[model samples]
Target: MMRGEGQELLNDVGCICEENGALDLLQVVVGKGDVYDGIWTELQKDHASLQAEIGYLLQNQQKFDVNLNVRHFGKVTKSTIQADGTLMDAAEKIFRGTIDFVRGSADSVGAETEQVLLLGDDVVNKTIPVILCAEENVQGSHGAAIGELDEETLFYFGARGMDRTQAENTIARAKLEAKIQKIGDADIEQKVKTQLAEVLDRDNR
Candidate 1:
């Protein structure tokens, strides 16, 4: 987890998986600041696998950039998920990801997905997803979603006595909550939820 308060942050991460091994990672960031996050992962042997998920919520005049690189050295599986939300026109974000299937990485499978929610028009969002394959039997896929809330959805929340901002906050919270609920430790999960609620309340204020 990472948080920033009007300062710049840079997070660089690397991971390697050996033969028949697996790796899983989750990263979350929230606040009003500038952030640049980069991750590089390699599957070094047959049957190795890697899974990584990243979530971020930025409000006010914040900027975020994320980059991910995955290399399949052998037959392996790699998957990545990126979920991001921006609540103000001054926020900006960019996501860049790449998956490379090397020559010996036959039968390797890789997938990447990114979802972004925009609450205002002046927010800047850029996404670049790439898959490069040198093996004949490799499979790679990527997809992304970037948009604002629909009027119908807003109306549904309004009917429940929630204003437009409240509805948008609820939707954004759901994205992070989905991941938080997956924590294996109940105590940690609850603690995170509480902290998240406090943060959301502060932001709303």
Candidate 2:
């Protein structure tokens, strides 16, 4: 219905839109270069009743990428990818509502998004490889964090019993475990657990 920002919109590649509703965007960011590389396949039958809302908060240096695919019948297909890579090449997405046919992956198919966050003199690097897809009858949502400890959360943990290092380790391990459980893949889950344990042990050393 209404599109703003006068931003250069890419096509048939990184992120594409083929829908009927107005893409109400507010200060979205995207990476530069040949970022688009796929033809999104969406069904066109259930139109008129599609809605989406997106919000992104990012901080980084490298490039960021996003791809979306949405379909509806008897109406039009809609796909959107909005982001702000202001601080860093941060990747984010928000999907709320239903779909007739769903396909494709967001969070970079075969690329790795790495970021290094610094606190005082301590430096830690984080790399996140995310591939998310969902089939919803009504509504669905997805989110990710591919970085080190949060200052506030770490402070809370330290205030309780852990030192800075111990708190970071504990929080990192817990985050990994939660991510593994969300995936629900046993093999990968065990691998993540082992890696988290190693990281935690190293923190003590």
Candidate 3:
């Protein structure tokens, strides 16, 4: 299902399993011009049922940059493209994050992209899934890859300025803001922003 502008949209992007089964899902989020800035969210629930308990979770996140005509300007843009998939009977779960960018103006060319992936429970037992791809085309093409923060990075931050939890909160806030900017309503965007801020604060614990 899909939700349009004006009406706030929330959807469960994933499904659970009662018995063994296969599931496939994909999602695409685009950031457009002035009238298109708004927040969008997809929640996936993997609850176990009676008789037998099985569950799986998958996620994907990607960010792309667009090159518009130089004459077209004054617009706010943001997007959170997420995918979730799970296989029942086998009890397999997957979580992936992909961020792709087509950054920069055509005149002064530059290329950069980034991706991140997250998996849980059954997913960790499986192989590390693919996170990004660059179609053979040159115009500033590169993706800065980062996995979830490592313990060492957290420790380093703790020793310097922030506690481990604080470091995590900082990163989460940055990402949440990027997603909200895509939410297309000023009032709604602000509401989601404040709600996200509260979530980040709680995570700092």
Assess each prediction's global lDDT (C-alpha) against the native: 0.78, 0.34, 0.31
What lDDT score is found at residue 143 in candidate 3? 38
> What is the C-alpha lDDT profile of model 2 across 64-154, one tens digit per residue?
2334444433333333332211122232222222223344322211111222222222322222223334433322233333345577878
What C-alpha RMSD separates each model from the true structure?
Answer: 2.1, 14.2, 17.4
Error of 2 at 200 (Å): 5.8
Give the alpha carbon lDDT tens digit for every residue of 1-205 in model 3: 1222233323333333222222322222321111111121211111211111111121122112212111101111122223222211122222323222222211222222334323222222222222222322312223334356677978888888898556755665555456556556798768666654543353321
TM-score of 3: 0.34
Q: Is candidate 1 or candidate 2 better by lDDT?
A: 1
lDDT per residue for candidate 1 within 163-191, as digits (tens), equals 98789779888988887776678987777
Q: In angstroms, what RMSD does candidate 2 have relative to the true structure?
A: 14.2
Which structure among the candidates has the greatest TM-score? 1
lDDT of model 1 at residue 19? Answer: 90
lDDT of 2: 0.34
